[model samples]
Target: MGTGYEPLEVLKPVADDIWIVDGPEIRFYGMPFSTRMTVVRLSGGGLWIHSPIKLSLALKARIAALGQVKALIAPSVIHYAYLTDWKHAFPEAEAWIAPGVERRAERHGIPLEFDHYLAGANPDWAADFDWLVVRGSKTVAEAVFHHRASRTLILTDLIENFEKDKKPWWMWPILRATGIAAPNGSMPRDMRMTFRGNEDLLREDIERMIDWDPKRVIVAHGRWFEDNGAAELKRAFGWLLDG
Candidate 1:
């Protein structure tokens, strides 16, 4: 999948102990779309997986190779589609849920035995790192993570990365209208419309993320910036702030 700017393939290690799996190919649906799942190795050898899309036997084997699957983190309610598969593969690993995921899980008949729920501005589980929930977005309670050491920002549906020229015809008008289109090609309009009435919270939350002075920004649907990440974030969220 495109991170809305540059296109990449498979899981690429952008930082030490952090790997990003770009999505855009709905391998099952046979449709082109942008999606991503990030895998991280915690300081203590536990592994954390965020926004995982597909968990095939081969992928699971690969993940097992990285480290023991200590936890499966669903960054948003909508991102839990593959949780069952991942859980089946790693039954011993606990499932961590964001806010409002239980209802969605039940509706989809997806068992959510969430061992932890991210509450308030600071969560105890988050040691040495910080995150915030974009309060106003109707899509889902999206918990964005900012890793201090790597200067990385991990996101879910909050931001998208897809190039207009690269998108199918039906997606163009949607991308242009929402102001997600960037000269760099990430966060096309498909995701911009989802930000309705949540601009202030998003801007505030993102400002908090930037205060950490991140050097890299990893978007689920787009490319990850290796350099000048804060600038890229400012550019990405500028419209929401200005509006």
Candidate 2:
């Protein structure tokens, strides 16, 4: 089994105004996997939490010291479990929903309502981000955000960079089978299946992302691209781009 990995750690800085908190390890399909939450400090001095993780009192205080939690977002359906916790803690924060998120949450027995649906541009944070709804997936849709100030692209599950050495021994086969078990950080094959016939639509979105020209990409699972982020992104999504 994977050992030597820490869980529920403190928030660490990834870049200017960007912090991440590592969360507990959990199992999916009998494989050990971990989760993480990303926090971005907005220009208004408020905070925008992306795909929030489990909240501890210590972590909560740490975040409070940073700024008011202004926006609590569920980047996608599967990433919303901790939304309620943060909402209760920061009731004043807007709980924004991504495209097709409401229905997915409802179907999954997760009761949550979106205060605002993410559309064209958000007046509050629009100046700082470029938002897109990743289409072509039959079962799921993810809202991707690119932070202009930090030159960082934030995604919940589009691409996973799993460190094979950090994962349990039993998970190797499954992770490899999914095409997400390290060596190279790329979109998982299972998620690719969700795209199915939506190749063109998905490609269009990727093309738009390329225009942003980000310097880093943060993902919810596994590892994030720290340098040459745009190049890595193009490389990872080559399947659609090449065509």
Candidate 3:
């Protein structure tokens, strides 16, 4: 099935040297969730892919036209489903994963070979991106990124803005309760619970993202913010930022 942002597997430019590809929806907990991937062409002419979706020959060709695929990012434990396919296609690309992903992949019986664990500074793409691991969550840790050139903040699941019209009627209440409904979506409640005692840490990270002054915010699942990204960050994290 198509995620409203159709023409799947095709590159849709978000800014200079940056593109987002909407992918097919995946079932999670019996609910269908949309997926997206971001592609960035670094200054040195190499492509950096984040939260990759299902790979296709057409998609691969399109991406190759942009630049060589240098890095494949699994930004969160739950977002690495298609990494293996991409890895097979681009044998030379480095697979950089977030914390806990290795264990999660192994548990799911998905054999994945990762080249680097995302943490601290990496000279490879540091010149074009600023990133940080969102700490304090007991369940999951996400590596958030900000593309320096386009001022675009790339997020996996930190904040979801699923549009009501795009989802089934049965998911309306669930989405509202989870606080992920579009135009007002924030961090999901269950994920927020994981940061109970260490909200301060999450708050600090949010502040740092706001400091980036991103012009647009690209989320993996939902309608992303195209403008006033700093304000959107504050609004999305209002639960913690307010307190």
Candidate 4:
């Protein structure tokens, strides 16, 4: 909870109906970490919020003008920090849980509740998006989504694009050690190392995503890949591509 950082930014549209915000800062790993949220207006005129950040009074008002906030998602156990706030604001929005998160969230005292689990797309959003499970990491498992209407792929922690300058000075050394600094941001070394024997399963999923040939890719942190997303995605997870 950083009160000293910049104001919450106005939501700006990136693709046809996709808008992204470099959102509120949350304290993580003993320091503040920046956050990002993606909002997509589905075919039925309903809003699908991914990796939701805190809903402030102004943000809530702006979001109301968008459409009904019909779907709420916690893409991974690590991304659930603000789901409770959003769900509290839009009670009618259906909360969807990612696989392996129900138990993880509970253990962490998150008490996440879900109307549906994301093993596959739900009927409400299936028409608008396709999904796959990044089923390798013992520490971080997440669901990756492809927003078909805008040709944008949304990922949580599987890929991080944290810029070095934007981070605090203390994080610089850690960022270098973790290999998630700007310019060449890709799948974190910690995450990649965990894939170990499950390389084929993760590679198969990344291959399907590459096939989508997304026009842009929105990772949870740092600068998103606005173009050449397919190639970047293939390159980011390059470690898994090999046998």
Candidate 5:
């Protein structure tokens, strides 16, 4: 039997105004998987959190120092593990979720009371952000959000970030075989799966994202991309429209 490799225990800041905290001392069949979290402080007193993992007292204190957390947002149901804890920590703030995530939460036995999510419906919340519901894909009902001021595209599981050279031995095969891992961690497979039968709809969403001209792309499973982020996105998702 093989002794599984240990989980990564480092948190690195990969972009301006962004920090990625990898999981510590954990693994799946010797493959190390890390969770990514992003903290975006919007104009004025608005704060948007994307896929927050566990919030220890120390982590909570670190976050509080940034500013008041105006809203806690989760991109999908699977990413809500720390929502309750963070909501308890920041009870004054509102909770936001993606489409069909609430039902999935209930099924997964996770307690969640989200104030809003894109459920084949429109959002009537804050005005500093715009959200897109990638429709026609029945694989998953979730919405992706873009922040205007920061020009940041917040995503979870929509992209992968494994560095081709740095990936742990076990992960390389799985990621490459799945076509979701690239030299820069591309989600070819998942992106393909995400679009499924709704290729045109996915294209429209990408065009919408292009309109925003975001400066950065944040993914929950991989490194955050900056510096010609739009180009990175074009290269990453190019496989979809091109093929």
Candidate 6:
């Protein structure tokens, strides 16, 4: 029911104005996958929430104490499950989704609306974050972010570092086979195949992320890097970058 990162829905500060919440696990392709969310209080005092999890009254109260939720971001197509609930809670918060998310939601009959499509750095929160849509993946174009203030790189499925001990025995082979096991996780192999002809584009984007020189990296699933962010980026992405 819960991932190793307990104390769900409570804000865990990562840096000034930035915090992360570890949420309950959700099933993906019949496998239980852990979920996490990132919250950032913008300079103007509005909250930016990334990949919201199942909402609760207690969580809502905690968020209200910080600031008004202004932006709810669906960083990838598959990460929009809780957007509708979050939208109902913070109607004023603009919902931003990646390119293919709208269609994915529609197919699943999830009635969700969005105010902006996350392409490049939009003027709305550009002052605080640097972002990019990881090009070359025809199936999943995840929008990755770098918080300028905290020097933290925020990613979704791009890099999953699942700890073996935290996962069930049945998931060990799957994790190792997909190369998403902790201490050495990279992009999943199947996802990598989607970029068959466009490795260069992905490499370019990874290069830019490495250039940002993040201090830490926060991922939606699994263990995130707490320090040496750039080196971790290089190491995690070595499979493609080295080729």
Specify the highest-lDDT model's number: 3
The segments of candidate 4 whose C-alpha lies over 4 angstroms from its true place after superposition are: 1-9
In the range 39-69, model 6's lDDT, one tens digit per residue, is 9999877999999989999999999898899
What are the models' TM-scores?
0.82, 0.93, 0.97, 0.92, 0.82, 0.97
Residue pairs with backbone atoms closer than 3 Å in model 6 (clashes): none
lDDT values for all models: 0.70, 0.81, 0.91, 0.80, 0.66, 0.90
When 5 and 6 are scored with TM-score, the better candidate is 6
C-alpha-based local distance difference test score of model 5: 0.66
Worst 10 residues of 4 by lDDT: 1-10
- What's the distance in Å from true for residue 67, model 4? 1.1
What count of clashes does model 4 give? 0
Per-candidate clashes, comma-separated: 15, 1, 0, 0, 1, 0
The local lDDT score (0 to 100) that residue 79 gets in candidate 6 is 92
TM-score of 3: 0.97
**Native-vs-model 3 lDDT?**
0.91
Task: List pairs with backbone clashes in candidate 3.
Answer: none
Error of 5 at 135 (Å): 2.2
RMSD of 2: 1.8
> Considering TM-score, which of the candidate structures 4 and 6 is the better prediction for this target?
6
> Model 1, clash count?
15
Model 2 C-alpha lDDT versus the unseen true structure? 0.81
After superposition, the stretches of candidate 6 with alpha carbons farther than 4 Å from their true spots are none
lDDT over C-alpha atoms for residue 161 of model 5: 67
